[model samples]
Structures are given as structure tokens and as C-alpha cells.
Target: MQRLFGFMCLVLIATAVPASAQERLKVVASFSILGDFVRNVGGDRVSVTTLVGPEGDAHVYSPTPADAKKIADAKLIFINGLGFEGWLPRLVQSSGSKATVVTATTYITPLKLGSHADPHAWQTVVNAKTYINNIRVALSAAAPADAEVFKSNAEAYRAKLDALEGEIGQFIGQIPSHRRKLITNHEAFGYFAKEYGFEFIAPVGVSTEAEPSARDIAAIITQIKKAKIPAIFLENLSDPRLIKRIAAETGAKVGGTLYSDSLTDEKGDAPTYIDMVRHNIRTLRTALEGVTMRG
Candidate 1:
């Protein structure tokens, strides 16, 4: 096994083991990205159920009684925090789950959002490693019997993350610095912009649920015109009208769609978490490298 380092903590499973060998730690991850991280680090040691499944919109999701049952029975609950899952507290209470509720993004320095904390830390692979490690620690905490296993799994997964981060850096570097500015539908790419040294603008702010007022929209259009942002992009979970109107009003070409709130369809380019990151970098690079602002 690879050596383990520290900056953040890890949760090792030390509690009662399930009766069967196949028996695993019952874990409920608040959404797809966190759920995927838990799966990767937990490996066969845990059973993770995702509350927000593939292409599921977390911003507008309404949890049902069934989800409440899952949370109550889970050994641990993992949420992205940073106001990403505003609906979680009530669900946990309704479920009567005393299970440890851990923010998977707890280890990352979350970007100070416009009004709320940005929970999309997983966008940056470095921060993603934080989520991976925290999930390992959370699983370990809930089921301590698998402490060593969780550590081993976390170490291995983190190595993969290291490799992934390197690749993302190299891939992003391929795009000329001047061309790296991203204008997207929401503030979802803030961490990505920060980590990659790209300046990004969103007609909308952090939460997809918040609608931009006429003044806000006008200001965004004015900013777009002043900045000459070449391409305005659509996000997975937001309405297309705002981005489209901004692009039209600003005369910026529409960039391809970006995955902000959800993963791609199961059969599409970014179906899996790993693929999702790679696809995003690839998409951004292609669009940024090729696009030019009309004279």
C-alpha cells in the first residue's frame, strides 16, 4: 500500500461489522459526485446509495419519504455542504437519523460564494482529493472495523487523483491563457476558474435557484460587452434562456454546454465522475482554443 499523508483527517470504520462478508457500511451520499467519491474510496467495503442520481438536479430536488427512510437507516450521511443541499437538514430530522452527517467538502477551502458557500469543490481535482479523503474518513468513522481498509483505499484513490490533477493541469495548459476565460450559466465553475487560473463570469450567481433581476441581467450583458467574453456557455441544470439572451445581446458566440449541476446522461461523454472531469477539460479546451470574438 502507498504511504498516507495528512493535512485533513480520514474516517476509519471501527464499529460493528455486518453479519455477512458481503455486508457493508450503509452509506447515503447527498448527490452524484459525492456518491461517486464514496464509491471509489469505499470500494467493496461500503454500500452507497445516492440521493441525487445521475442527471438529478440537487438545487431543485425534493426529497421524498423513501429518501428519509434511507437516511435514517444509513450508517453515515455525506452531504456536499456549502448550502448545496439546502434540503438535507429537514430530511435528516424527518428521517430521525442520528447518523453522523459529514460534509464531503469539509477538507477543502470552499470558495466564498456570493451569498452562500460554494459546494462544487469536486470540480478541482485537488479539492476532489479532499472529498475522497474525507469520504474515507467518514466511512471509517461509521464502520471503524474497516479503518485500515479505508486508509488503504483512500491512499490508492488519492494517487489516482494526483494523476488526474496533473492531467487536468496539462490539458488546461494547452489552452492559451488569453483564451481561458469562461463565461458560463452560473457560478458553478468558480473553483475550476480559481484552480486553473481562468477568469470566469456568470450571468447568474452561485445558486441555480436564484433568478437574476432585470438590472442583474443588464449588468451581466454590460460586463460581457466590456470584457468581450468570446463564448457564453450553458450549464446542465439552468434554463437556457438567460445564457442565450446574454450571448445574443453581447454578441458572444455560444460555447458548448458545461456540466454544472448534473453529470451527463449515462451514455453520454461525461457519464462517470472521472470521465466527467476529463470531458469538461476537453470541452473547455476545444471551445476556448477554437473560438474567436467577431470583429
Candidate 2:
């Protein structure tokens, strides 16, 4: 009888330990990029649900009933919030989620494209640091028990970001100023261009959902010819046809497909935020280097 009681107690303890270890903060990130940030900061302490998955465009994303259920179940919801997720407010309201909503882009100065704020602030490494910091604060506040863990994780991630920034600067510096121009499918690279000293021209506006008018395409073609821009890029989330059209008209080569607003799936080249930035810069370097060699 004594032996049987001891065995039962051991089994109960074993089951309880796993349950406690498995308990994690429930969080939802509006997109994959932000989801990466949360996972880095939250580490094993969070279970993150991303509404917009890998290679998915958030600008035109339609939330479903399943998405609403995820939102309702989340303890916290993170958004990019420089008007990036236009559909977020309605979705949150409809779901009636009591979860705390945190805007990861808060406190950073945003680059403006005319009257609209350019929401792709994370394109720049400096802005990305701010985003990580914001996410750290949100996670810390949500789970004070793991605040130290979040802080440590954020610091480590920031160091990586610092290194990435240095890499980008050094790489872009190698390209001659005249050869630093880029023509992409959309104006998603404004923040990147502003930070890296490149002139990025696009046919469509900030949002990918915005259709490029005939005049817009004509204007970009004219700019490409007048500026003698050497390389044009296709965005992963955009229609390559428009960029191909522009490239054909201007005789400018299509550099490569850039991961703009979303990350590639797990098995693809850009599986993480750091990988995405590195891949883009590497792609840019290769194409721009070719143009310089030709020139």
C-alpha cells in the first residue's frame, strides 16, 4: 500500500510539472514580421498567433471567422499601427477581444509619403530596434514574472540588429552614389532608402492595394529613363507584371524579387527578420554591382 501511494504521488507531480512548463502567455501579432519580433522578445514565454502568415500581404488581408476566434482568445494583440493594418480596428471590434492592443511602431518618427504615413518603418534597422523595444515593453507589462527574460532577449536581439545595421551601411557604402538608385514594384522601401542612401522609385504608392494608374506607370518609366536607373525589383507580394512592364520600357534589368511587406515561408530564403534584411541587401548588392560594372 505504501509503495502504491508513493508511485501515484510521483505520477501526479510529473503531470503537474509539464502543465506548468507548458503554460505560456497567449499573444497575437497582426503580421509575420511583428510575430518574429514578439517571438524573439517573448521567447518560450509566449505562444504567438500571427493573423497574416508568411508571404501573406496584410494590406489586402481579409480576416476570417477563425481569425476572430484567435483574437478573442489572445491576451494581447500587437499591431504595426502607422496605418499599416487598416482592417485591424474593425476586426478587433467585431471580435470583441478584451486583449490589450499594443502598437509596436509607437514613439518612432515615421517617414511621410505626401499626406499618408509610410508604414514600412521596420525596413530600417534603427526603426526595427524601436519596434523591438516597444514589443519588449508590452511583453514585460503583460507578464512581469518574465520581465527579466524579455529584457535579456530584447538586448540580445538589439545587438544582432545593430550588427545588421552596420552590415547594411558597409554594403551600401561600397556602391557608388550614382548607382544606388532602385526601382521597385511599390513605395515600400522609403524607410530603407532613407536610411541606406538609396533613391527608390515605385509605380504604385505606399499601399500595395493601390492600383498604379497609366500615368503612374508612364511617370515611373520616364523617371527610369531620365535617371538612367539600372535595376528594378519585384516584390514578393506584388504582381511582377507591372515591374516587368516598367523594366521592358526602360531597358532596366529586373534585379530580383525583394521581400517587402512580408517574409517568405519557413523553407524559403527569408525565414526570419534578419534573414529577410540580409537577403534583400544581398540581392540589391548583386544587381547594383552588375550595373556599376556595366557603367
Candidate 3:
């Protein structure tokens, strides 16, 4: 009778314990956006550490000794490849990590800017789905026992992405074709522009670290005037002075800030990948919908 009672107690305790009670896989994401993706797919099965925090620029990020420690301790390291993190190679070497490096943009057809493959592929909702798929596969491979959990989370997240894409299209549809053109802080929105049928002009190149020369700024100012671009918006990761100066020179309104390259913290507008896309499109629509394009 005591044995039966003990068996019943053991079963109850086992049933009461949550699935998340299992040991979590430690993973490191190169940046905040990738960190968010890992969290959504990984759920409670993984602990993610982002090397670059929210609103932090990855283009010019300098890896620290602490980051090296994080890498050494991780079972997997996720990054946005296409030369996004130039500092990652050295960091990995220094850390002597055996962690599997997963490139989130593995299946993406990259957009070229000059001689560089644009690294801001996450700007478009479609490519963001690809990222989620890649992360899901990687996570499943790392933790086969939790494959079903990862799969379910990824499918649900992809559905949300599809809905987000529809929402973006609806917002863009409301804007006039000619008025769809705008000037951004940098060349980070090529994928977004291509996917949604918008024209984005920028003074600087793909990498935020690249500064626009006088000639470059002058060229952008000329283009904005000639094309009658509606607004110039500031990017969260970029210096606002350049965009502000362009807006001042061309009489284009300074549209609200756009979250590019990095996301804002939890209290800010864009805390997650989906939130980032929604915030950008809404900001664009609000700025361009009422403006009339003159030839």
C-alpha cells in the first residue's frame, strides 16, 4: 500500500513539472534582431544572449572580452551573414568556441549595392520569414528532442509574418505611386523598397559607418529637389544630423524616426522583429499619405 502511494506521489510530481524545467540550450545572437528571432522560435528551450543590444549598430560593433566569454559558453551562435558582422570572425577565433555558427540569411537572394551584398535583408517581411525558417531548422537540429516545439513556434510566427506582410501592403497601397519615394538615412531599405514597390534614396552607402562626402550629400539634395521626394526620415542606428540637414535643405518634412539596422528597447516603438516592420510602414504611411508629389 505504501509503495502504491509513493508511486502515485511520484507520478503527480512528474506531471506537475513543466516542460520548460528541462535544461535550456545556451545560444548567442550577433545582434538584437537575430536575438528576437531566436527567442520567438526557441521559446523556453533556449537562453539567448545578444552580442549587440537593442538600438546598437552591428556594422561598426567592436566585440568585447565579455562577448568572447559569451561565445565560448554558447552551444550555437546565430548571425546575419553577407558581411554584416566584420568583427565576428576575430571574436570567434579569440573565444575558441566550438559553437555551431548559424547564418540566418542562408537562403536569401541578396541585393547588391555597389560592390557589397546588402546585409539588411530583414527589412522585408518575406526575407524575415526565411530567417525564421533558418533559425527554426538550426534550433531543431541542435535540440532534436524539442523539434516539435520549435516547429510549432516557427509556424505560428510565420503566420504572423504573413499577416504583417498583408498589413504592410495595405498601408503601401494607400500611398500614391509618385509619393511613395522618400529619402532615408542610409541604403538599408533596398529589400524593403524592392518588396513593397517604394523608392528609397540615401546619402550614405550600405554600412552605417560610411560617411557621406560633400559631393554625396549635395547629390542627394539635388535628387530630392528634382524628384520632389516627400520626406527624409532618421534611422535609429544612424546620425540624425545628416537626415535633418537634407530635410532642411530640400524643404522635405522630417518624418518620424525609422528603426533600421537595430531595434529599440522594450519600452520603445520596435522591440521585436514584427514590431519593427509594423512601426516602419506606419511611420512611412503617416508621413507620405497626405503629401502631393509635384513634377
Q: What is every candidate's alpha-carbon RMSD to the true fold?
A: 10.1, 4.0, 4.4
Worst 10 residues of 1 by lDDT: 5-14
Of candidates 3 and 1, the better by lDDT:
3
**Per-residue lDDT for 190-210 in model 1, tens only?**
888888988887654333456
Name model 3 segments beyond 4 Å from true: 1-16, 204-220, 234-251, 291-295
Q: 1-295 in candidate 2: lDDT tens per residue?
A: 9999999999998887742287799999999999999999998889999999998989889999999999999999999998999999999999999999999999989889779999999998899999999999999999998899999999999999989988888778888998888777667889888778899876433334566676877877888899899887745325678777887899887797788788888899898999999888888888888633221
Compared with the true structure, the alpha-carbon lDDT of candidate 3 equals 0.87
TM-scores, each model vs. reference: 0.80, 0.86, 0.86
Candidate 3 lDDT by residue in tens digits, 1-295 = 9999999999999899887885799999999999999999999999999999998989889989999999999999999999999999999999999999999999899999889999999998889899999999999999999999999999999999989989888888888888888877677889989988899887443334566666777877888899899887645325678777887899887788788889899899899998898888888887887543221
Checking candidate 2 for backbone clashes, the offending pairs are none
Q: What TM-score would you give candidate 1 relative to the actual structure?
A: 0.80
